[model samples]
Target: MNKKYIQCIGTFSIALPLLAAIILTGITSIVKAHLLGNFAESKNTYKTEQAQIAVLNELKIQHSKKQTQLKQWNQLLTGDSFTKVNERLRQSIADSNKTKTLQLTDAKRSTRPTYAVNAPRSACEFKLEGTFSEMQRCLTKLECRMPNLMINTMSLNSQINSNLLNLKLNYTIWENAQ
Candidate 1:
């Protein structure tokens, strides 16, 4: 009976440590899996946030470009009244005529169709006589000096026995709407 009791105590001591080791390993595995899951979830959330930030940055760049273009367009617009604009146009044409052989034969103002909803425009028809080179120089000066003036139509006819050309020019001036 004493030997049997000793054997039972040995068996119980070994089994207790083995069972404790197994239980501890199971708990460790469960904790590791939970931690790994949380890490994965956080990583996914970070990626989503980064994607949204990139999109917003792209949109911001596009908006900045649009603003710059708008500013440049505004620089090409005149805020003066139609009468003032017309006077300026005539003065410019006269100035061009003085520098070159271009002669202003006739000038007329006509009603022009508006191209923009918020911008008003004026049109003028001009008849001039000059050589081709003189006409070219005059047109170049007008275009470069007055950014608001746009040439809508131009026609040139050569005289039967002369070096001079008859030029018909239609131009439009864009003004800022009040």
Candidate 2:
């Protein structure tokens, strides 16, 4: 009876330790899985935020570029009076005719509605006879010399019996409101 009692005690001690070890291992596995899930979720959130930041940065760069372009255009605009602008326009036309391949047949000017509260607008229509190359050269010269002039429309028609092309050009200019 004494020996049997000792054997039973030994078996109980070993089994108790084994059971406790198994429970501890299960708890540790569950905790490890939970931690891994949380880590993965955090990584995804970080990536999403980084992508949004990149997009916002790109937008800022584009805005800066647009602002610079606007500044350059504002500097290019002429602030001359209407009479001075007309004189300059006549001079530009004369200068373009140095090659003798272009001729201005008619020119008309009229007041146009203000495009902005601080800027007044005027329109000009020009009828010209020239070769295509000469007309293009004249247009380029005019635009370069008069930065405030914006070409609104243009039409070209080839003459029936001549090598010259008829050109009708319409443009607008902005002036200081004051």
Candidate 3:
């Protein structure tokens, strides 16, 4: 009876450790599967973000170009009529201190409708005497005040002293055709 009891104890000890090892192996496999799934899902999310970033970058470039075009169109819509262009030009010249030395002449404008939109335009030619800096400032001011003024031609002649400059410019101003 003693030998039988010892044998039962040995068998119980061996079976207990084996069962525990089997349970541990099952748990390990389940944890490994869960970790692999999480890793795959993370990889997919990263790829999606990369695609979205690429699309956003493209949209940013197009948005800048469209914004510039919209600004130009808005200026065209808000620009002054033919009569105001001369005043704006004179004001710009005055601001640059070139009004006293400026010579303005009216150009031969076509009375017929030339534009597809039937927009009336006034063309004028002007000669200005000043330094390069003054001329640049004058141009800047004219552009700012009269957004729809288009300079068709510009010619510059420098004097012997190089400090004096003569600039001849041809410009056109667009007005809404009533």
Candidate 4:
């Protein structure tokens, strides 16, 4: 009886320690997986923020270019300067007309500014009846001549009974504020 009791006690001691070891291993594995998942999420977040910063820096550079262009377009708004700009615009139109045998039907010019900012702009609106190619060339020439010209709006419509297209062009040129 004494030997049997000793053997049973030895077996119980070994079995108890083995069961505790198995439970501890399972808990450790679960904790390790959770910690690794958090690390992966943090890494992804850091990368996304870095990309956004790069885009913002690029936008800042573009903003500086725009400011420099504005400075280069400063004007004193003299009568002679206005006449020159107007003559250049008319010459551009005439060249386009000669290129494609088209004519300007109606034209309007206004010194009223669309934006009431530190720099004011004069606007001209032209209505032309011609083929699409002719009107496109006209616009290209005007843009080339006046690099500071802003195309505020443009609309094209096909004439009711003819193959010709009706083009409306609204353009603005900036002037310095004194």
Q: Runs in model 1 with CA error above 4 Å?
A: 1-100, 114-118
Q: Write the per-residue lDDT of candidate 1 for residues 74-103, one digit (tens) a residue.
A: 755745434544555456566666546668
- Writing each residue's lDDT as its tens digit, candidate 3 over 8-60 gives 88778887788899999999999999999999999999999999999999999
Once superposed on the true structure, which residue ranges of model 2 sit more than 4 Å away at CA?
1-86, 111-118
RMSD (CA, Å), candidate 3 to true, equals 8.5
Off by over 4 Å in 3: 1-83, 98-118, 160-162
Model 3: clashing residue pairs?
A: none
**Comparing 2 and 4 on lDDT, the stronger one:** 2
Backbone collision tally, model 1: 0
10 residues in a row with least lDDT, candidate 4: 72-81
The runs of at least 3 residues in candidate 4 whose Cα sits more than 4 Å from the true structure, single-residue gaps closed, are 1-86, 98-100, 111-113
RMSD of 2: 6.8
Q: Give the TM-score of candidate 4.
A: 0.48
